[model samples]
Target: MQPLADRLRPRTLDEVAGQQHLIGASGVLRKIVESGVIPNMVFYGPPGIGKTTVANIISQVTSRRLYRLNGTTASIGDVKAIVDELDTFLTPDGALLYLDEIQYFNKKQQQTLLSHMENGKLTLIASTTENPYFYIYPAVLSRLTVFEFKPLKKEDVESVVLRAFDTLRGESGESFVLEQGVAGYLAAACAGDVRKAVGAAELAWLTCPPEDGQRRITLAACEAVAQRSSMRYDRDGDSHFDLLSALHKSIRGSDPDAAVHYLARLLLADDLPSVCRRLLAIASEDVGLAWPQAVSIVKSCVDSALQLGMPEARLPLTEAALLLATAPKSNSALMAIERAIADIQAGRIGDVPDHLKDGHYAGAEKLGHAVGYRYPHDFEHHYTPQQYLPDELKGAHYYDYGPNKFEQANKNYWDEIKKKHR
Candidate 1:
């Protein structure tokens, strides 16, 4: 028996589910199809979002010769062989070449396709799960129109489930009824992936006993087959963004346990890069001078992520998470920048005081530059505030030291220096 995904593979755009933004009546792709003027395009999206299906649809609609290659398995020689085949069947009307996982193609292999696409020898349609702007070569990217495909929605997944169930009943002639909750459960567990939804449905049918003709699929059965009780935490989805928000708030709130829990969730979901980036933000925003080492630790973790990649990189990420959770919290540095930005946006522009302007340049001294600027090093504790700020905001104070240990110590140091100056 054929697998559900294969059995239900869409043969036309009408049969393909979801991605209304691309395939709807007034969608960009629909316009391209109606015009019969398909350009070289790169399909940037997650897996099983009908990239290949759409490519096949285009080939069918246009009656173009289609040559498909899997980047994971196809060799350079295989690519050349296909190109050779294209040459044999070469006509005034060009052919379409579909490359799967185009990111997996090394620089040289990607370069090989440049001329073919440029000269219109083949209408190139490439697909990848990764962002092409980062992974694809610049030269190749310049010549391609990039289309992003989003994951299938829950309703779309449910629709596919019903269609699959109908197909199964029609083929098997066995009355199989899915419980009311089973469809929703299966759809949710699939995480916006139609392929997984069909697989789970098929698994439930296969595992049912032959004697139980009236067997109904349950949540337990679905969970057992899907290997998850509910939707998995998608790093690019709502849960990911929400958890990061909570993590940042917890760190700012100085709640170590809550911060740790959020960190653990992100780690388990394999969102290490985003975790590191957010931690870096927290370091500057919440830690600042209160715990200066926190920023360095976060930076080091980001570097470690670049060096180690996944699995091993989780270690440094864990260290950074713990440090951020326990670090003394302050928002003074964050407030300082926020205030500066607010002033700028409010049209509080100020000229560089003549005394502070560059003096090393030829005409600097003639323009009264560096005329009255005091050298702070010559003063006690290297401290001086000789009108550094503009006249309009001379007495403006942005950073108010918080009640953290490091902040209090810094406040004391500044106070003593101010006393000497006064």
Candidate 2:
């Protein structure tokens, strides 16, 4: 009942498609296996990116005894049973206990491993999709070196997909025809998850009835299968955050093409609300003052989107995204507000000048509130120098406007006014 991904799992270290950083010849694992003394470690990363495969490869190459457990289901009793079994073996490096989703282990179950790990009964290889610091117990973490497994690259996924077909042909003597670029399409669509890529390919394979005694898979077939999988828009998952991030960064970096690409991805995810919110923030925080009108444009786009919904709404959104991507970018306003906030948080406080205090209240005249106020309308150019900040930050400079043509006039006006004060 093993899936195609598991069945086609790489057997040797050299066979792993990606993860060259950790499993290459000069990798830490290689050094450990070469030394014949494997230690406890944790492999942290997203799923289907070869955590279990890497662990299996390490155990085989190092000739260490291997025991596998799932954190969600494994218990203290299971740990005891495995340790008890391994206790009878006189292996020098002890057995390797591979626990998937190690974050699911409760403190009590994890506690059972403390003595076993310390005594060399098991060299633990724990894996988790969540952050290890937040999920793994400090005691268990202290004994394991953490290694991160990145999602496999597009080429890696393609290689895995192609290899599966190779195995199918070798076993059945039937050639599976992969339409040109179908492998790449599946690879890219899986978001670097090799296992997901294989599953998609498998679905496409199963859906295709053989023509002339050979199966042919195309992008359309893979997409048809992907419709029922995670390729659908996940509004609250990692991909949601990733697409929003990509869109923001692309606009900030002045890449209209990339910004539009990420926008399309968000639309594919069907997360219109999140897209609108992120666009609004980007217009203000990123495109602030540079293209002050960007705020209105993006807001109009969002308003139209909410009113009309998708497909039709994508037009205005695209226009706003393109406008932001091509606009000169700055964050001076955001930085200025944050700096002011920090000053307040650091206990910066000052009494308002009598002239600036609330003088509209009863007895305000006796308190000298507004007594010495200098009306700016009475001064030349209807402008007068005044201290608006708290006493401690009277002349603090926060805004650093970039080379934006739209803000140049504002910056020049300040430059002349500040000169008068100087």
Candidate 3:
């Protein structure tokens, strides 16, 4: 028997539930599908959310040839073989090559696609349950636009559940009774996974046989099935990113309570590494220079989490997140480096001054390298001043001190030193 998910697969963009941001009246994907001109892009989100289904629908709607290659099951050789055959295909209108779980393709395997995506033998419509930017080769990612799929809102899931009810009646040709709140309960339990939602409804049917009257589906029946399923996390879904953002921002915003709440969400999903990695970043980007010790503390917590492993790992992870949340916040260090790097990249400055160049080489003094260099220790306050920036950017200031104790103190000292030098 076909799975309820496949049976209820949406044939048109309008038939697709949720993703209003993508398939709504003004959605980018809706426009692409309607225009009958689709580009190579990846549908990125958690599983059972219509990445593959959307790809299939696009091909059918546009009447385009489709070539599917499973990244996990298909070898590099298999991909090449398909592409080679496709190069000589009779279809004038190019095909849509649907690669499911494209994250499984390693760098070497994905490298093969650089040519096809460039030459356009086919339009690539890849689907992934992992973040494409992290798992996919940069070359592959560069060639394809990423369309993020967010989790379905509750009302959206309820609408799908209501539709599934109709589909079941037509399929079974029997009167089915959906008890009050049963559909909503199922929808809520599935966590935006339509397959789970539809399947649970189907599973509930098996629990109670058809009688002379309507076979009513109840929340109790659905709850038994929900027990086997885990949390509603699509690790690659936008919710994952959203919750992480919430956690980071909460910590940076100085609310440890909100930070811990978001951290708990990831812990339930067993995504501690992502949390830890974010904590480390928050330590630098948000807490930066203000505490200065936050980076080391987060790093230790990462080690402890890995060594201790999960459940228990949540402890150190929580500590790390809280530490970041409570730490003094400043971006002076991060912003300063960013501006300096930008300057170098834009070629906004000349070569290092002669005084700043390496002068401890043969005959270097004769060429006046380090000619006017002043050792800071050779003067009062051990802070003799001289031009350190490139000749074209002399006295250029990059580091702007925020009004934080750590940075403000340093700024005052620099100001005083500059006064003495002047």
User: Please, what is the whole-model Cα lDDT of each candidate in the order they appear?
Assistant: 0.81, 0.82, 0.83
Give the RMSD in angstroms, all C-alphas superposed, for model 2.
3.5
Tell me the lDDT of candidate 1: 0.81
Top-scoring candidate (lDDT): 3
Whole-structure CA lDDT of model 2 = 0.82
Instruction: Flag clash pairs in model 2.
Output: 233-269
What digit string (tens of lDDT, one per residue) describes model 3 on residues 305-406? 989988999999989988888888998888999998998899887987888778989988998898888887888888876677777887678888888998
Tens digits of per-residue lDDT, candidate 2, 236-306, equal 44456667888999999999999999898788667888888988999999989987888988899899988
Instruction: Tell me which of candidates 1 and 3 scores higher on lDDT.
Output: 3
- Winner on lDDT between 2 and 3 is 3
**Every model: Cα RMSD to truth:** 8.8, 3.5, 5.7
Candidates in order, TM-scores: namely 0.67, 0.84, 0.69
Candidates 1 and 2 compared: the better one by lDDT is 2
